[model samples]
Target: MNTREFKDMDLSAYFIGPKGENADIFKELTEKLINEHIGYRQNFNAEDANSISEFEKTTPEFTNAVTNMKETLNELSRKMRSGSIPWTTAGRYLAHMDNETLMPAILAYNYAILWNGNGVAWAGSPVSTLMEEEVGQDLAHLNGYNENGWGYVATDGTIANISALWMTRNVASIPFAVKAVCPELVSDKSDWELQNLSIKECLDLLDKTGDKKNEVKAQSARSGKNLQKLGKWLVPSTMHYSWQKALDITGIGEDNLVVLPVDEHYRVDTKKLEEIIQENADNHIPILGVVAVVGSTEEGAVDHVDKFVEIRDKFREQGVDFAIHVDAAYGGYGRTVYLDENNNFIPYKDLKDTFKEYDIFTENNQFLKEDVYNAYKAIGNTDSCTIDPHKVGYIPYNAGGLAIADTRMKDTLTYYAPYAFQEGVAVPASIGQFTLEGSKATGSAAAVWTVDRMIPLNISGYGRLIARTLFAARKFHDFFNGQKFEVNGKTIISYTVYDPDYNMIDWVYKEEGNNSLKSMNDLTQAFSAYTSSAKGGNLYNLDIITSDSNFSPATYGDAPVKFIESLGISGDEYYKEDKLQILRASTMSPWVYDEKSFNYWAPRIKKAIQGKLELISTNENIL
Candidate 1:
């Protein structure tokens, strides 16, 4: 589509369905449901009690509560006015929140809320329980796990991550438990030696433990034992805060969580990962597992999953292997790039043109980049994954997912409460038995299921939406790095974008000067003048996220700090503060798909950058 015409494209078409047919059908279905189920519960034969409204009138306390609620809502409405993040304003956003959702999801959630269904079990929410099962299947297929695999929804990425790690810790210990109890199955092998054993070997050893096969089938319950035999976990430095909680809750002590170094792109260093595994092995610490972040919380960096698997395979050859869990809470759905409507792999050549057409064409595009593409493609190869539909899937709040490549992994972590799920029962049938949390919201599952039905979890669906968001991010990156301001044919200010990994810079700002805190702070102030609500203006008010780049000599040492200093970028100062602030933009708005809309938004952002630099150069306090 041409830029101007693209601007006019009806994005809601994706939400509402053909000719608004589904929207009308949905409305009609909801009305019918209300008429049958909730259209006045009182029968004509029964005398009516006092209505809730009448009670409010007669009871002062109830009336006061109502008044307080109204007052609070009024205050909230007033505060909401100052909020400037517009979902429709092209791709000028730098926030991780996309603020995009579909009509079906909203409608489905509304439909389910009236019932207030809990998905913990079939008895509580019959329809929603089945819906959740369907949703799990949909999510699994997206990550290349078929019906043979197993997954379910959780409250958020935190719970999903914890669940995945909890499973890993338990599964890692099964071999050790068997070795201690039944030495013949794994002759002379210590628990540490058994940790690296292949899955087949682990299962054989489990059989020898004489803990009835039924226990493995339905024993996700926590033993509360500090099974030190599970050993330590390896994770990239860019890990989410939830990992620590996973370690704490799983009884894997904080000291056992070994954080590894990340490469220039903020991805886990594969070489370093191997080194850590070897070092742990040398020390006789049975390695629990390695974590590969599919989409890091900050910077949205993707780790080398493909390389992780390759290294793991090599380790397997040496009788040294460990579970690999992918924390793709943010980026798992980005796997849409690799699949088509039928969940079949699309040829790279075919995808290249579509990527180019979307203006996301770049060497850094994961689908185009061999290593990155393989990383995404290898998601299903991992033991388990955390995928949040609430973030990229555009579903309503509190819907995260955990998918297991091998359904057998669930055998170790299964927990059965007599009151919740009976012992010896399989999950989904007894879904609550397998999860960390009980009493889950079935409405969340309905929302995901309803949306996936309308928006297929494949290339022509969510993939296209994601591609637009990515294009927007790349566009902003290019504009900030490349644009130069000119007045009356005289050269003026320019800005630099920090993309040390891709090296995607114009050097216009670099030639003028290097990046400094003063420059960055000035830029922030000027940008705020245009985009901040207090300024009575709006365009693209960028937000900055800072990270602790500086570390103690033991944690990170002087080498990284020295490297930044070598670039003439004041690394010495940042080293002391333990900060590396970067301007991040999340072009997650689908509206940015239109070139015309993005073009309109892009220029103003450039103007803001140029204007900031000019103001700073003229006066130190002008900002």
Candidate 2:
């Protein structure tokens, strides 16, 4: 786990990736777009794609959308690089990106390897590559990871969560699996020994659960090395759906996954989680790693890390074994700036007072911040965690991260070579190596470094920036809550500081006659978009946006754009069902400062809502 043992940790030396071996792949992609984007665009391809047929034929959207998306992306990239984009831009997708290094990072990454697939490792991403251990160590140190841990960088939060889960299932179950099916080999006859296995392992041994025999056979089939261990993984019901996805990949039935309930604040009910762990403990239902969330997706809910550590301690005291995986994708980076009413990290006790002002929402969700985020003051123990620079760190899109508390977990899951294992990798930088992913990109690492330059991952810097966003959230909450709008039912601008986990001041304007997801989505979208539109009325658009998409038709088409839209939310959307359009606000931009930003934008949002009401009231036939 020490740097000397992992001496070759630097991946920047020879070549970024597979290119050290083969370089042509890099040439082809660059050649495809070379001489394309050196300066500001004076001209653009006419919107008419039919005129130029070839460009429209193969991956038609690839050329058109790719060009458009990249153009806008590059613009935003330049602003982010310069710290010139207003805080308003942070919550919305705009022409301005985070930083210019984003381009160099991508170009260098693409220069390093030609990846058109999954990004699991060097073997899979020969063209993409492994990063230097030394650099990764720096990342570890930044996140306050334990001194001697080794880890891999995943493509996104979902992948990172899956990787952590897989590691959890494997390390916890493998040894138990070996013992379960061959129980006769053991000399120990104590009842406590049997309880040490997974529910599946213990069931396989007892033929106990309803379908005992079938369970045994299924587990036996899954035991062929690939799935030697899997049973119940204790995670919050509030966990990301990806945990279910990980279940499918591991061949462990999702039915076996235990979802511990969440508290009023939407945090995992750590107490309930422990009861289940203790209940199953003596029964041999091995409690796999306990996955806690530092920043949950639904409400920005943060699982109490300190409480989780306490659970870890109690479980260990009970002689039970499990790892703790912290899903801090949304909130991890905030750990550094978790200050007192003032800011400081050295005297770091639970300085929960700094968050006192935000706690007003906990009563009626009428305030800016809440007590929940303050709970962050208590964090300590962790096994592994997910951190995304793309999120709170404000790096450009597609940059997520993972940091494990226990560096030893890397050793538990590492792949080695038959001959001398290189100090860095026993794995190679070509396809079909030891990875669940296929291709890779080093651009992410470069971007991580670039943004860290702008905002350090310590308590003072990054935490301060994130705190501003929360202030913006609270400001928007107050503005929306106090204002009068035309919705029939109670107009709830839900940035109920009660849940600091929530990003948008979800103004659930239930139109008097209809408040279904579809109706709500339509109305809310209209309210947010029109208010946020630069062309709307008096508002300058300031590049700030925050609004969510409706999931009512219960389909997935607009979920992603809807989520992205909420970031600095507001934009046009092509609704497939009714072909209706509406405006909305995402209210997550820090540019929503005191006098200048809010004064200009809030009135515009109100006016937009009024205009929409007039439309709804006038169109009785449509309703």
Candidate 3:
């Protein structure tokens, strides 16, 4: 994958069409799928009588049913076309964490659904189950995991996070279980020490049980008996809401979750985290794990994962440890930016040279800042991570993934469902037994597998696509920084909430002399109607489509305080209103970086903002 070869590649071939440009390509592929399905049916028992006889084909009842189905499908398609968001159009859709899915993924999903295979077990979906395994390995490798690691697809990142928490909870109890079941295995450790053993040490103790592993596992927290011994879980305030649900569902009450405040950049405060860990250790309070977010949902902040690894190692020297899990649902695939064609991580010093060689980031290298690069590099050292294919992998919905650094961690969450697997089948044949979901759809697996096969998960593949989005976000941030709008002789200033760590940029606006946070929130909220697809407004009357979010002291603690002051709002006003509103743009589309697209849309966006400001000035309720 040389720069010339990558530049020469046709990016349009990967997308169906913005306006049916690739309709013929899609039609041809669909015909092939239909023909293959017909061949499969014809090859099986060709001599047998037809399931639907020729006489039935002529019946008016059947004819009416087919006609009714066609009419219903047409009606549904009409409604969808009118109501749905135009996510496929790169220029219009800047909202949310969605964009155009890859053509191979769409086609593969359609092809796989003809069989409706269930990925729960090999007995039910032999071919697709194996494909799921391969997809797992692909994701594992994409996130810096090697042969010793193992991964699997889940329903979504919520499920993946919950499963990781479940595994951590159960694994944490293993040392205590071993102490009770086989005293000699953990004889050198006291009860207090057993409760505080690191995740790896606990897994090692389980391995020591060998023949009695199942019995020891039964005595662990999975049996719902030792839940109290599993200790507290720590996560940043920037963590996804799913972490709360994960804690709640896994029997680790939300009260036990310690939410650390983020720094000015919205990243977790490592100093506070270290202090908490040291305090917990001194008090003998067992700590189960710490979650680091690679891409947070609200601000798209990348936590200092490298700092986390260093903290863990620092405490490990003092005989204190906990598991580290990364919630990278939105930014996991960005790791490809640092990987070569062979999937090896590029050294930090050579990263610029590599990008130059690949003809990417040639104009601006700030997209790969030192902090962001090191954070991605440290992901391999974490115990586990949650990644979503639909978010960053450019695949269709219902595909989330989990990767564990060690394959042996699978033993902690294993179950037995006799009907799902055959007696002689081996490990992966019984994958359902180790998963949180049952009867998972093979379409998602097939879609992911197809995309990975067509587009490798390395620098030459996903890296190129992701790099463009990074550049787009940086440009958007730069475009809005210090921009001003004049209305009614009052100056309205525009500011990005923070420098983007990935592709999401949050923009805020406030009158130059106005220090009222509520007024700012109202103005920004009013402006959102223009850029959003809200009902009661003209859907097409927009310069761009963007999402909106709120930051407040309640959920984020003091994270918004500094940002609020920078916007000329006082701390008293911030606390009084309790919220700050901003427009969010997720520039996941690669086309946004093109010079023509940028030049065309950027001014329109500015015009739209100016129009909103003039409208607000005339409206008495807004000021």
Best by lDDT: 3
Q: Write the per-residue lDDT of candidate 2 for residues 1-623, one digit (tens) a residue.
A: 32231112221221223112324544554665444432213235544344546745577566787789889999998766554333323223211112222233345444333333344445444333444233355445545564655444456778878777765555444344434555553336443443244322432343332333333333442354434233477777657788889877876668777877776455677777778887887676766667877766545667777777777677767666666777777677666555432223434233344333333122232432334444454443466677766666555456666666555444334444433234355454322122344344565654565444434455334544555555556666566553555444334332122324534333444344342435545555554544344223433333333334332212223333443244233323324343223222333344443445557766765665565555554543223
Higher-lDDT candidate of 1 and 3: 3
Ranking by lDDT: 3, 1, 2
For model 3, residues 1-623, the per-residue Cα lDDT tens digits are 33344434666688886676778898899899989999998888888878998999899999999999999999999888777777777666667999888888888988898887677888788878888889888888887778678788888999999999998898888988888789997788876787778777888889889889889999988778778777789999888889999989999899899988888789999999999999998988878899999888878899999999999999888878789999999999899899988789998999888888776777768767899999999999999999999898888989999988887787798876788754446655456777899888889999999888766787777888888789888888898888988888888888899999999889888888888888889878877765666521555445567788898887777777888888667877877888889888888886776566688778877886787677667754664
lDDT of 1 by residue, 1-623 (tens): 31232323344564543234457766776687677556446554457764666646779898798899999999998766456454434334444455556666776787786776677887677788888887877777778777567788889999998888877776666655554445466677755577677554565556665655554333322455436767788887778889999888878878889988876556787888898888877777777788998777665678888889899898777667888888888888788766765688667667776655534444445424666677888877777889999888878888999888766666676566676667655544556767888897777998998877666677656766776666665666566654556533334443433342221111223222435644433444444443334442432234221111122334433434543454466866555545533334455566655567677777666655565555444554422
lDDT at residue 242 of model 3 (Cα atoms): 93
Top candidate on TM-score is 3
What lDDT would candidate 3 get against the real structure? 0.84
Question: Which residue pairs show collisions in model 3?
Answer: none
TM-score of 3: 0.96
Cα misplacement distance, residue 429 of candidate 1 (Å): 2.9
Residue 201 Cα positional deviation in candidate 2, in Å, after optimal superposition:
20
- Candidate 3: where is the Cα deviation over 4 Å? 1-8, 422-424, 488-490, 614-620
